[model samples]
Target: MTGDVWAVGDAYEVYVGRWSRRVAPLFVGWLGVGAGRRWLDAGCGTGALTSAILAAGPADVVGVDPSRGFLRSALDTARVAGDAAALPLRDGVFDAVVSGLALNFVPDPARAVAEFARVAAPGAVVAAYVWDYAGGMQMMRHFWDVAADPEHDESRRFPICQEGPLREAWAAAGLTEVATRSIEIPTVFASFDDYWTPFLGGQGAAPAYLATLSDDRRRRIREDLRARLPAGEGGEIALTARAWAVRGHKTAG
Candidate 1:
């Protein structure tokens, strides 16, 4: 991958999650930033929520991710490492399991969810947040706006964040009492330069774009983004990011 996956993950460590920040309003809200005593954070990226979980009062957290680079950043905050699909932990050993915007990225998110449920004790709460790609993920829509342009084939190169197939797969994984809802968090950027600089870093789909662009094409993209963003009354547009929250309980054996 032209994108340094680790660098990309690390870049996000400083930047907040547009979608993952909205974990508070969904029905699974109990599993808030600190809902578990001993929590397992599956697909925990850069450790934002994992760090939040620890502060929320968990004794110890095991944050897992597939990226060694992302995990490197995660280590700065918590005990984060490894894969979510096949966690290196024991069964029914966790009081709560939380995943943040990670389900869509994994190859088998369902199996990963099942793994999360398995490690959680019976009656333990399993919670996660996924972006609503088809409906409400605004930042994603902004990304697609550029990627979908005829001047670029960026969509094909970047991964799709479609929500339907993922949710169905989650259901197939035997996560019962599954309930979902949308939560919105406002993203505020200080200026166009602040927003545009991250794109130049080329760490994510946005960065993938910079790698492919001719100088003119790159400038056009940058300009297009700048033109689209309205100046905030308070120097920031209160952009709303949407994510779907899902929760299920492990059945008592």
Candidate 2:
């Protein structure tokens, strides 16, 4: 198994952070939590969702992630080095507990969702979003389709990214009013180089796999992607990314 590498914050920003930022506001807005509520951004890689929560006038927001390197790039907010499955925070302390684009990467997503519930106050919203890798996340779907390796495909590796699994996880964690939706955003690359260069950064699944390939094989894959991706006359490649977002409320005590 080719493990995903996420140490380089700059590389991750280019690869997926930009798109995750686009999804953050939408996910936050969907929650519709009122101003002045405390928020906990579990698995808050580089603070994409944490920044969005801040923009919503929260009383306070704390971001927790295992990546210290990524934390350095996060916005000025309360941050802690922690894992999603086992957050280093007091229980029932937050009005909103959220994770974005990070749930699928967790080794045990059910445990993480339980932690989300544990940290959330009664009636608090516990929500998360993950890239729809199997179908709607075109950026990754294109890569895996061209890469032509089912073993390396994230869709196969992370079945919990889908709607059914997400809702089930939330419900099993004892959350109520569990619901799921798709958040789609435009991913327009300035050119083929813009799209291809990020894959060479080796920050995520596809790039990690690419790093294991021989130079000649890498060139072949790059050329294949260049030929396959739809480019306009202006040399812009427009694609879309979709994330399945799940939201639920901790039962009021």
Candidate 3:
């Protein structure tokens, strides 16, 4: 399997970042954490969630991700270069720990949940969200369907994006009151170009697969998607994206 390329922030912004930003506030609002708390955004690619937390008036927010390139483009939060599975932060230090649209990418998602639980203060909220690639994330779902590679389809590759797996992971992390919900948002593309150009960015899973294809194959795939996608009179392609969000709390001391 070709490793998902996540280095270029600008390319990522064009790929998934734009849609992820739409999900951030919804995920954060679902968390409903109180203001004036310390927050940690694990796997905080480009600080989407971190920015939302900051807007909610957190006393402090720290965003951590392994990609320095993405971190450089992140908002004004304190950014750290680190992996989610083995966070380089002290234990029980944050009032809230969260990740957004990134949990499925971790090699060991269970271990990353453990790390989220570990870094959270007692009774602190620990949460994360991932794209519902199997069904509701239409942008990628349509791409994968047209791409026709079952092996590389994100829905097959990341089972943890579903509600059951996410709830189970949170509970298995020893987190209390684990709950999950779906957040849906509009992803409107100006035209076929708006929808297809991001695939050429070479950032996420679909784009990475696209990069491996011959020009003829790529062109065929593009035309297939252009025909299959539902477009409006003005060539606007409007789709809905859904993300599964899970939240739980550590047992208070």
Candidate 4:
């Protein structure tokens, strides 16, 4: 749990890929991608963003992530296993460069932003989004409210996951017409168990922290979240997942 959870690889693609589905379309919709254009999906975990981009009718798409396993699972796009700050592709060839729910995890978000701009052609769009972990990301908020470990708080480290930081980062990367917005999607769980089971997978920050707890403590945390969640008809627990998205165009020289 102390080390990087992504080191295990593929576990995130399995669990996170499902969790992110609710918000994926919102992220892509904000992008307003055009048909028959090339795209670079940086930090394209399990192809969620890439798949969304494909559905938007891009002529071609390239999916890149640090996890080879994730790239393996990516849909028909050209997949690259590489770091976000140092993409393996050439510069200014893509019509658009986008990332979803991954900018926070990059070693240097500003550098990643710069890379996104670098790989984009003049007049190309550059966009990215990350979960608003401090407020609207209900699933993680529930887990952290129970766990209450400052060191393990995902929101604390993700400085650029909010609108302000996103705008600033985009500007600093020399992108123009920068704008930001929030996207909220519904996450419905069949039962408390449906929500709790994924925590045991040890994929993201919350699950990794949950994995570190003693069995008794884990039980207490589970009960805490279960008691707090607002269950409705058919024992369903509906929660809102929110992400902060930003977009800008590379300057035409």
How far does residue 239 in candidate 3 sit from its true spot (Å)? 0.7
lDDT of 1 by residue, 72-159 (tens): 7664545546677888888998877888877655666667877887789887778777666554655545655755553433333323
Candidate 4 displacement at residue 155 in angstroms:
1.3
TM-score for each of the candidates? 0.80, 0.98, 0.98, 0.94
Whole-model lDDT per candidate: 0.63, 0.93, 0.92, 0.83
> Could you tell me the TM-score of candidate 3?
0.98
Least well predicted 10-residue stretch by lDDT in candidate 2: 50-59
lDDT of model number 1: 0.63
Residue 83 displacement (Å), model 2: 0.8
- Runs in model 3 deviating more than 4 A are none
**In candidate 4, what are the lDDT values of residues 41-160, reduced to their tens digit?**
898877777777766664688888997766666787688889999999898999989898889999799999999999999999999889998989998888887788877688886878
Q: In candidate 2, what are the lDDT values of residues 59-119, reduced to their tens digit? A: 5999999999899989888999999999999999999999998899999999999999999
Ranking by lDDT: 2, 3, 4, 1
Candidate 1 least-lDDT 10 residues: 152-161
For 180-234, candidate 3 gives per-residue lDDT tens digits of 9999999999999999998999998999999999999999999999999999999
Clashes of each: 1, 0, 0, 0
